[model samples]
Target: MNRNIFIANRLREVLLNGHWIANTNYKEQLSDISWQQAIQQINELNTIAALTYHINYYLRGLLTAFETGKLEISDKYSFDLPEITCKDDWDKLIQDFVKNAACFIEKIEQLDVEVFEKPFFDEKYGSYLRNIEGVIEHSYYHLGQIVLIKELIAQ
Candidate 1:
């Protein structure tokens, strides 16, 4: 299998369609929750909505870099999610997240295998493969948090 295709599939597993890794993707986990439930706080952990926004933040930023050849994202602002007060707001965020995740996967699928070994945007950040895998691992980390938070909120 093409490396790009494999990587894209792995991303899809977490973000959109596949369920082998966690038995639930972001879309599945998020699809049924209400805005109120999304924002429910539990013992100082991030709300589901906030974690969703955080992952989407990286996806959108990386998509921009893939399209425009500029890497402008900062870790400091990755979690700076705006307020989601109503269902419209939460729905819009989810919609944006879905769109960005799809776009991000497409960008990965389009990359040349050689590009994966090249420095992402700067040598300081390491290779494109490093960053892409980082996103996957980082997403899973937060996805676990989201699942646990949902369980806590239910209890």
Candidate 2:
């Protein structure tokens, strides 16, 4: 196999694994326990919903900026975001979030790896590669929190 293709495959693999890990840590339920139950007994210091939603928000922002050359604001998709009512809404949001995240990885793959060294945008942490990896690391950190919170909710 060509070396470039090999690297491309590995890069795709990394994105897939990252997505898998993120999802594994938080199963989207169509019949989740009530929100009150989800955070019951949990301190306000811990963000019961913010952690997951923020990762999705950031990934969407980064990918949209890179692909469209337009920087994104946090609430850009507020209108489309799912409501915090039922489990179905939660599931839909997760699906949309994952779809957008995959699109981000695909766009990154379309760029020359050299582009990774370029600024992701005009933001403070503008380096493309760092932003990409930062999202992954950030997702992983929040994913861990989500898993722990879910376990607490279950208990």
Find the candidate with the highest TM-score and give its number: 1
Q: What is candidate 2's TM-score against the reference?
A: 0.68
After best superposition, candidate 2 residue 47: deviation in angstroms?
5.1
**Could you tell me every candidate's TM-score relative to the true structure?**
0.98, 0.68
Indicate the residue-level lDDT of 106 in model 1.
92
In model 1, pairs of residues that clash are none
lDDT of 1 at 146: 89
Model 2: residues with Cα > 4 Å off, grouped in runs: 1-41, 45-48, 74-82
Clashes of each: 0, 0
Give per-residue CA lDDT, model 1, range 16-121, as digits (tens): 9878989888999999899999999887899999999999999999988888888998889988989988999999999999999999999899999889899999
